[model samples]
Target: MKLQTALRLIYPPRCVSCGDLVESDFGLCGPCWRETPFIEGLACDTCGVPLPGHSDQIEHCDDCMRIARPWSRGRAVLTYKDNGRKLVLALKHSDRLDIIRPAGVWLARAARPILQDQMLIAPIPLHWSRLLKRRFNQSALLAQELGRLTALSVCPDLLVRPKRTESLEGKGHDARFTTLDRAINAHPKRKHRMAGRHVLLIDDVMTSGATMAAAAEACLSAGAHDVSALSLARVAKDA
Candidate 1:
């Protein structure tokens, strides 16, 4: 038997979320897949939140309309609820490196509409202290995988977080934005990469979009022609 097939026989592919044996690798089982709220049809153009009804014209969600988004466009693979939340948490805190493959594929599909020719792929930067604690940046991993799948140029350190901000957990919307303001900046040595190019920022989740706003603003300050964002999950109020 082939070595690969032998390995599969020894250790069957399992669902990323529930650990149930699945038919294929890097995917969820049928139950978990159904529970995961994949965003589809009539999503907000600015934030990728699922909106009611269908429309051909560009539309923005209420939150996006109220808040200023520095990025021109955005997309997200799943709504932050049920299995979606579980997947994001696993990737972010559980050291679930296995989730990167499926996430990259989903992110690439979501990003297709906003993709521009010769665009640069980057991830939201984590503070040095947090990086030390976590040992890895999930966003960076996702960005690298996404670049591999899309054949785009990936700059892992394109952005930097000079100021360490407290966790946004349990913080109000205004507080979240206040804490992240002016916290992120373009890396001095790599700032040239952003000049005159369309940059795509990747993140594991979009909560209040405060972090994305800061990162997008940094890219714009460094002379990026445009900034776009893609996330594995988006935290929507109704979801």
Candidate 2:
């Protein structure tokens, strides 16, 4: 028997969410897949939130219209609820590295609409202290996987968080932005790679978009030609 087939038979592929046996790796079973809120149809051009009805022209959600998004465009793979939420949490906290493969695939699909030539993939930075606690940055993992799938260059440390900000959880929208403001900056040594290049920022989840805005601003200030964002999941208000 072939080595690949032997391995599969010995250790069957399992669902990423419910841990049930599945036909393929890094996938969800039927029930879990159905429960997952994969974003589809018409969505905001800036935030990737699903909007009512359809339009040929680009659309923006109320939040995206009201808030200042430093990135030129954005997309998300899933709505932050149900199985989507579970997948993000698993990757972020449970050390579920297996999810990266499926996430990269989904992110690649969502990113197709906004992809630019010679795009540089980078991840939202985590404070050094936080990085020490977590051992790894989930965003960095996602960015690396995305770069591999898309055949783009990945700069895992393109951005840095010199200062650690408190958690944005439970904080109001304005406060979240205020807390993250000026907190993210481009790495001085790596700024040369970002100059005059289009940058795509990756993150595990986007809530108020405060973190993405800060990272995008940092890239722009560092002389990036343009900035765009891709998140694994977006915390939609109605979701």
Candidate 3:
């Protein structure tokens, strides 16, 4: 066996999606990688939610109109289930910085249709307490990776998570919205940077949409011409 191969075997890389052993650092087994749902076809032009059972020409899911998302549009590379949850947890808790590169590259490629027109990238910032506890911000890592893939500048200081709130576990939509409504603030120093720019707000996942909503609100308040969101995954509403 080749020395490099033997050394790799000694350390045996594991897949991020399924935890299967692999020979390289791809973070997913070939099958799991292929199975990750890349949201496609005619989706809601506003929210990126797939229009199920509709023709390819269909656009705008009912939820988009009912809830009224603040961002102009958004897209996610995966549904937040199965392997996606594993990958997200690994990236957020296990310090898998390498995951950011491939995932961000994939997300950028998936979002090419819209992201190509965006002028600036800003990550949804974490509250200082959360950042201190985690020692890093997953959104920042994703923004860096997306910047590397898209050649767009990542402005990290544009948004600030001003206050920490209790965990959102078991929270309903109204409660989540209330908590997030008070958590984010626009950085005054960076307000001028948003003027007349189409901003791409990057986050690791879109759950109840409250966090992104707050961030997008801050961006709009700072004078961004328009704002859009791109996330690695979206939490599917339970059936």
Task: Work out the TM-score per prediction.
Answer: 0.98, 0.98, 0.88
What's the TM for model 3?
0.88
What root-mean-square deviation over C-alphas does model 3 reach? 2.7
Ten consecutive residues with minimal summed lDDT in candidate 2? 63-72
Which scores greater on TM-score, model 2 or model 3?
2
RMSD of each: 0.9, 0.9, 2.7
Q: 1 or 3: which has the higher TM-score?
A: 1
Candidate 3, 147-183: lDDT as tens digits? 8888997898789987888888789989999988858
- Supply candidate 2's per-residue lDDT for 140: 97
Q: Which tens-of-lDDT digit does each residue in 87-191 have in candidate 1?
A: 999988899999999999999999989997799999999999999999999999999999999899999999999999998999999999999999999999999
lDDT string, candidate 2, 117-223, tens digits: 79999999999999999999999999999999999999999999999999999999999999999999999999999999999999999999999999999999999
Q: Count the backbone clashes (under 3 Å) in each candidate.
A: 0, 0, 1
Q: Which stretches of candidate 3 lie over 4 Å from their true place?
A: 1-14, 19-24
User: Candidate 3 — what's its lDDT?
Assistant: 0.80
Ranked by lDDT from best down, the candidates are: 1, 2, 3
